[model samples]
Target chain A: MKKTPLNQVHRELGARMVDFGGWDMPVQYSGVIEEHLAVRQAAGLFDVSHMGEVEVRGANALAFIQQLTINDAAKLVDGQVQYSAICYPEGGVVDDVTLYRFNGAHFLFCVNASNIEKDFAWMQQVLRESALTDVTLTNRSAEFAQIALQGPKSVAILAELTDVSLDDLAYYHFCEGAVAGEQMIISRTGYTGEAGFELYLPASAAVAVWQKLMAAGAPHGLLPIGLGARDTLRLEKGYALYGHELSRDISPLEAGLAWITKLDKDDFVGKAALVAQKAAGVPRRRVGLVMEERGIPREGYPLFAGEREVGFVTSGTMSPTLKLGIALALVEPAAAGLDGELEVAVRNRRMRARVVRPPFVK
Target chain B: MEFPEELKYTEEHEWVMVEEDLAVVGITDFAQDALGDVVFVELPEVGTVVEAGKAFGVVESVKAVSDIYAPVSGTIEEINDDLVDAPEIINTSPYEDGWMIKIRMADAADVDDLMDVEAYQALIAEES
Candidate 1:
């Protein structure tokens, strides 16, 4: 398994390590609930170095990105980031990514760690097929380290380390600056649905940056978060995870990503298929579920409406903040109405559940 | 991790405190530490019968879920109702207030098959 630049630092902090998508990452430091609550209430630091960074540069960068992603890349200004997805020809999602626009001729795509190699190969294949000669694609996944400082107190803690006036860094905007004497890209974004920033810097400078942030954040109740809390925080906000909410078999339309899938835009990969699927109406829809009974709903557990199996859960947990079992499930569109009665097959019993819009906590 | 010297242990990390024919059962400190923060617990009915070494209930944490096995075959006489509302007690006091169920032993001799404190410590050491 591959290790991130901060692997030794995590170990030194007594983080419980686990194998996450072939990367030895910290699953928890103090505990999942503690780390999760800290991120919601105060601030939490996360080592997200395993995430992939692919640079697309050259004169045809805009054209290449336009043909590749589902969202309108032309809408992005320099230093602005957009959440988008690449899809297969069949309209199934290839990977959901964050596209950072540096200029019309340069862009950076941050992709899920598990899909790094596959996404890079796919991009290369598409470039070759399109004959886009002016565009140069480089896989810089190993050259950069990313850290997320999330929660309400994140800005206060990070402001102590950098001179960049964070108040002017609007959401989804980024700026190049020095943090702890290391050149870094400070992006005002995060997965935790809280005010935060994601810092990207050279891999070799990860330890120094992490230590400085940790020391500065100590006064603000910042905890070192792990993948375990990352999942919970995202789930609470109704965010989609790659393997669960999307895959080669699940279209972004069915995954509730229609906002990002601009069918009216100029021709792009999967546009026609997505348009056709939309006309036909999405057969399945993703919905949030809160257990009305005792058992915790888990992934792959079947969902039932009356006596018929409607769909299955994608991600579920006993929410640490809510103190209730909450889940995200893909069910038949007709059966996904809010407050709809449903049941989840947990263990040997069918537990009662209710359909509700997510952001379950807020 | 603390293991009360008087409590007998099962290889599954359950601790049994024998009082004549009744045995109070709960998970060990090591087990609770591994499970992290407990969020919910599903307990069997008080009158339900359980088999030795069989799964009787489930203990859920924020990240994972585990089955709590019955160390000895018996009828459940009582359960810790407080855990349904505040399962985190399992992390704070695994051996005392977090006790899952009290069982009326079908065979008192079943205690002989469980490991004593010293043997249980050795088992944990070997596994680690």
Candidate 2:
């Protein structure tokens, strides 16, 4: 199993370890609910070093990125970031990624850890088929480590270590800055809906940076969170995960990512199929369902409107904040409207659930 | 970790305390510790017939859902209804208030096949 730079740090903290896509990672430190609630009310830090990074450069980087991702990279200015997706020609998703544009000629792609090799290969294939010799792609996954500091108190916690003015860093923007005496890329974006920052630094500097942040954040009740709470936190905001919500079999349209799909933009990978799919109308819509009964809805559980099968759950849990079961499900369009109840077949029992849009806590 | 000497234990981590023909059943301390915080529990209703070595209920932590197996064949006499609303009792008081069910045993001799405190401790030791 692969180990991140903070593996020993997590072990020393007595975190519960689990295998996540071949990486031996911490699933929880204090506990999932504790870490989750702490993040909601105060602050939390996360190790996201397992995610892959790809560097794109050359004069045609903007053109290549615009031609590759579903979102319009042409709309981005220097130091701006865009959330986008890469799709197969069939309109099935390749991966949803965060694209960072440092300049017109320099950009980077942060991709899911599990899809590193596949996403790189797909990009290489697209570059070759398009025969854009001005574009260059480098797999820099091993060169960097990533950390996320999230919640309402993040600005105060991070301010203790860095001189960078937090007031000027807008959401979805980044700057090259020194944190804890180490120069790194600090981006104001996170998977959690809370105001947060993601720090990208060299792999060797991870331990130092993590320790410094932990020490600075100690007085604020900031906890070192793990993958278990990460899932619940992101799910609470209705943010889609790669495998569960978006995958090769699921399209950006079906995953409710139409805002980033940019179908009207110049021809990109999978545009024709998406155009056709849109013309035929989307078959299903991703919606949030809150349990009206005691039973907890789990992934793969069937959902029904009356007696007709509408869809199935993609992700679910008993929200630590709400103390109620909430789920993101792909269901028929008619059921997306919360006018009536939907039944989730939880094992042998059919439990009552209602369509409630996400951000389930707030 | 507290596998009582007077109680019997199963390899699946369930504990059994025989009270005449009724066997008091619940998950062991080690099991609850491994499961972290218990968030939801589903127990069989009273009068349901259960077979030994079969899954009769479910226990869910925040991250996982696991099966609660029957230790001995019997009919359910009572269930811990408090667990449905306050499942964290399993983490705080796994042996007493966290007890899941009481079964009127179809055969009392079933306890003889289970491990004692010493044997259960050795089993968990090997696991850890």
Candidate 3:
């Protein structure tokens, strides 16, 4: 199991550890509910170094990225980040990535940890086919650590350590700055449905920054949260995780990520296929469900409309804020498009639910 | 992992406090801690027969769902109704207020299969 720079710090705080992908990460510190509520009401810190970072640097980096992803890379200004999906030739998503346009030549694609190798290889193969010159792809996941300080109180806590004026940095924007004498990239972005900053730095520098932030944010009720809260927080906002709501077999249009696809962009991979799909229309759609009955729905559970199997639950959980079971499911266009009652087979019983718009907890 | 000296334990991390022919069953501190924040718990209904070492309840957390096994075979005489509304009690007080069910023993000799305080502690340590 891989350990992050904050592994010992998590242990010292009595965090419950679990295997997240291949990394040994904390599931919770005080508890999931407590840490979750802390992030909603105040602030929370997270060790998100397990997320994979791939650096692409060369003269043709921008042109190369534009050809590989479904989103328009030309639309991104330097110091800005754009959410896009790398799709297979058939228009199915390989992985959802956040393209950080650090500069004209230097770019970084922050992808899901599990899809690092696959995306890296895909980009390399695609780059070789293009006339884009001197493109270099490097996986720097092991060398760096990323921490997210999230919630309404994030700016107050981060401002004390970093020289960067976080107030001016808009959402999805990043800039280089110094924190406790360590150079860092701070992005005003996060998975949680709250305002926060994601700090990216070398592993050694991250340890010191984490300790300093923890000590400084203690009086402000900044809890050191874990993946347990991270899931609940992101689920509340209906963010699609790579393996859960997203997969190699699903397309961005069907996954409710059509906003990120740019069809008008100068030819890109999967663009023609996606443009064809848009002309024809999507087949299946992702929708949210709220259990009208007692039981909480879970992933891989079969969805029923009375006795008929209509779809499968992709991701489901008991929403802490709503105090009800909610899930994201993929179903036929007719079944998902229409407003109707559905049932999820939970344990041995059927839970009555209603199909609604996503971001269930929100 | 706090194991009460007065309670008998199973290797599955369940604690049973025997009072006359009735046994008050609940999960141990180790079990609760391992399960994390309890979001929902599916408990056995009253008067339902349960077998020793069989799953009688489901403990749902944010990460995963875990099965709560019965220590000794018996009929569930009463179920803790409070947990349906507030399952977090299992995290706060697993051995006390979070007592899941009360069972009437089918055979008194079945308690012998369980471990005492010192033995249960040793068993937990071995597994850890």
RMSD of each: 1.1, 1.0, 1.7
Deviating ranges (above 4 Å) for candidate 1: none
Q: Which lDDT values do the candidates have, in the order given?
A: 0.94, 0.93, 0.88
With candidate 3 superimposed using the best TM-score fit, by how many Å does residue B32's alpha carbon deviate from the native? 0.5
TM-score order of candidates, top first: 2, 1, 3
Fnat (0 to 1) per candidate: 0.87, 0.60, 0.80
TM-score preference between candidates 1 and 3, better one:
1
| Model 1, position A140: C-alpha lDDT score | 96
Q: What is candidate 1's CA lDDT for residue B45?
A: 97
Best by DockQ: 1
Model 3 pairs whose backbones collide: none
Q: Write the per-residue lDDT of candidate 3 for residues A1-362, one digit (tens) a residue.
A: 98999899899988878888888999888888789889988899999998889999988888899899888888889999988889887888889988899898999989887788888888888888886788899999888899999998888988888778889999999999997678988898999989998888999888799989898788889999999889888887888988878887788998989888888888888887888888898877888888898778888999987688888888888887887888888887777854688889988988899999877755
Query: B58-100 in candidate 3: lDDT tens per residue?
Result: 9898768889899889999999999999998999999999999
Please compute DockQ, using alpha carbons, for every candidate against the native two-chain complex: 0.80, 0.77, 0.76
What is model 3's DockQ versus the real complex? 0.76
Q: Residues A1-362, candidate 2, lDDT per residue (tens digit)?
A: 98889899999999989999999999999889999988998899999999999999999888888778999999999999899999999999999999999998899999999999999999999998887878999999989899999999999999999999988999999999999999999999998899999999999999999999999998998999999999999999999999999998888999989999999999999999999999998888899989989978899999998899999999999899889999999998888886468999998989999998777767
Q: What TM-score would chain A of each candidate receive against the reference chain A?
A: 0.99, 0.99, 0.96
Q: Is the docking of candidate 3 incorrect, acceptable, medium or high quality?
A: medium
